[model samples]
Target: MGALALLAGCGLPRSGPTRGEIFNGSVLREGDAFVLVVTDRVNAIASVAPALGFSSEFRDAGLVGSDIISPGDVLGLTIWENVSDGLLVPTGQNATVLEEVQVDGQGFIYVPYAGRIRAAGNTPERVRQIITDRLGDQTPDPQVQVRRVAGDGATVSVVGAVGAQGIYAIERPTRTLSQMLARAGGVAVDPEIARVTVTRGGHTGSVWFEDLYEPGHDIALRNNDRVIVEADTRAFTAIGATGAQSRVNFESQSISAIEAIAQVGGLNPSLADPEGVFVLRNEPEEIAEQLTGQDLVGTQRIVYLLDLTRPNGLFFARDFAVRDGDTIYVTEAPFTRINKAVSALTGTLGGVNAVSSAAQQIAGN
Candidate 1:
């Protein structure tokens, strides 16, 4: 009995440290800065639940019109007159073809005789009417036709983590966020963890790439809008008595504590203590004040304790949210140490018995 007790006290093979040992190691030089919190309904309510969403301006922005022209657009104009000697065209030509007429930066396009006219804010049909009216007195019943050529006037820049990066025009088919992304050859990273950010006129909004197709998320695009697709960088460290001990990236936009544990293959069933699942994080000063009664100077070192034996323990875990950079540690069961010690002692006794039997046989011989 004494030998077994001594073996257990000296230290036996363990998957991880015990709950009491973890608490003992948490002490700091300044004081007991580590605040241990019991996971409950009250604490779960105060836990951080972070999510990405767009504001009203991002969601309520109007769609870009299909036929609208901008300053950087290219226009093709064909002019015809009733008489043989047309005003803008040559006498023998009957009709004049003006190819690749680029609209200037100030929204003006200079026709040969029509002078500078605004074409940026008007549709191709509207520009045609304006040009016909401009030559009405001199040309006598002039017929003008305006055709829009390819240009970057109403284009949005698609860059970062996409299969292809370029400036894509916001046509009728590619007016929404999802359509624009598809036009850019789609995201290169995993859709489960990809993030899409839209920056328009200095206003920025973001959403999970998986949620882009959802309702109210596929927002309308605008001219010169910058669409950036980036892979999620949020992750947490899993250590101690869990199945895996590595940094697990967030597989979804939001994950609860229970889901995070399952991502790491759950706690080690044979060695884990049901009541010793812990999450270690440095809580912000404001949030720490809410959790603890003290107004901390900087980030407070928090150790959130989760006891799975209680009636509402599972519910608490389901409600508690796990943030990025958090370290999830599960302590070993108390009896696991004693069991390992007993196994070691049993093996030692068996070896001793075998040696003694061999000595007796040799002596008898």
Candidate 2:
């Protein structure tokens, strides 16, 4: 009888610790975690400030003239003179073509008798005027035309989650963020959830792909600018007695707690505790301070509770904002453990009755 009692009362297997077990271990005994009841008031508060944008330094670097020349740019020069025998013109041809003149490291280019002329920081037309003035003393009635033949000038690299990754020249069409992304063949990921980041000098700025056309986000491209297109990586983990235990990625710019639950197929109907839905995350100090009404330093571990059995519970969950790196857990129902215990007890009783019957049969034989 004692052995049977021990066998029947043994602990049953559970997917995870129940709600009471977690509260007793972390809240009541350890006192390391704080539990906040999820309500309309709590849902209204922003858990933590999001880092979803760029600073003024990036926004202030607005649009600039896209045709300005830079060092290392390849210039194409075609020179024509009125006289057939005039200088810079070929003997048989009426014009002289300098197909590939490279801008020197010091922002100057040598043009035969024109000597070292400044080309960088000047438009192609401005450089043409400078060359025409320089050659007028030697060549009579000189006509000069200059155009950027190949991009070595102001260029930005487009990489990460784009259709084609390469160095693109910051030309007139590809001067802004949206234009540049189009020049790079658009983002490989969905534009709604994609992110575009521009890193210039020591400062880095980012904005959503869909927001790149917004006023301040469509900043001008600069020399050596690195533009990266990527998808949103923020996600929350769904565990415990929910339909599935998996890390679910954020589907949009923002996700509500109820939506997160639905992503993991919602709570398991048979085993889930309707009153034990919890979201665990390290909340910022300001929020923790507001909840506890105390001065707290650094981030605090918070376990937010949501009871779906209440009248306003679903509405509160709908309003709750689920943040990145949060863990949503749904505990098993209390009666599940009781059912497991009763099932074990019934099996034990059946075995005992069978054994007693066999013993009686043997004694009678």
Residue 26 of model 1, lDDT score? 62
Model 2, which residues run further than 4 Å from truth? 1-10, 25-29, 47-51, 76-100, 105-118, 128-146, 353-365
The global Cα lDDT (0 to 1) of model 2 is 0.85
User: Which is the leading candidate under lDDT?
Assistant: 2
The TM-score measured for candidate 1 stands at: 0.74
Clash counts per candidate, in order, are: 0, 0
Worst 10 residues of 2 by lDDT: 1-10
The parts of candidate 1 lying over 4 Å away from their true place are 1-17, 24-34, 39-48, 70-72, 80-87, 91-95, 104-108, 117-122, 129-143, 156-168, 181-194, 201-203, 213-215, 224-233, 339-365
Q: Write the per-residue lDDT of candidate 1 for residues 1-365, one digit (tens) a residue.
A: 79878998885666666777667756443345464656564465456555677879989988877777898789999999889877778877779999999998988999988888999967898899899988997889999999988675578899999989998877899989999899889999999989999987878988999888778888988878899999999999888888888999998777888999999899888878879988888887887777776667787778888888878888888887888888888887877778878999999999999999999999999
Candidate 2 residue pairs that clash? none
The 10-residue segment of model 1 with minimum total lDDT is: 26-35
